[model samples]
Target: MIDILYFAWLRERIGHGRERLETTAPTVAALVEELRARDERHALAFADIAALRVAVDQELTDFDAPLKGAREVAFFPPMTGG
Candidate 1:
């Protein structure tokens, strides 16, 4: 099972803080596709990939990054340091 977390507008759109999913996806992109296919909420949440930032196991990564052995994935906007 993989733990998927949502932040900011993503959480608001999906109406979920997090979810634990059993998936057969090999990459983050694939996982995203699977999630997006689940429902309208997920589709809306992932509609703009450019507006999303992903973290795998708490480390920032690309959507094409491999998901092997990853326990957690988080989706959020780019963090602005001021």
Candidate 2:
């Protein structure tokens, strides 16, 4: 199982901050597809891939990044500079 963490609006949208998931996804994009299929809340949260930023094992990564042995994945909005 992998820990999936949602931050900010994502957390609110999904109605939770984190979850442990058991999935066969090979990449971040695949993992997203799995989550999006879960329910409306998940689908809506992942509706705009471009608006999201992902981290694997606490290190920023792209959606196409592999998830072979990742222990944690985090989703949040892109950081904006003032």
Q: Which residue pairs show collisions in model 2?
A: none
Displacement of the residue 29 alpha carbon in candidate 2, Å: 0.2
> Candidate 1: worst 10 consecutive residues by lDDT?
44-53
Segments of candidate 2 deviating more than 4 angstroms: none
- Deviating ranges (above 4 Å) for candidate 1: none
| Whole-model alpha-carbon lDDT for candidate 2 | 0.98
> What lDDT would each prediction earn against the true structure?
0.95, 0.98
What's the TM-score of each model vs. the native? 0.96, 0.98
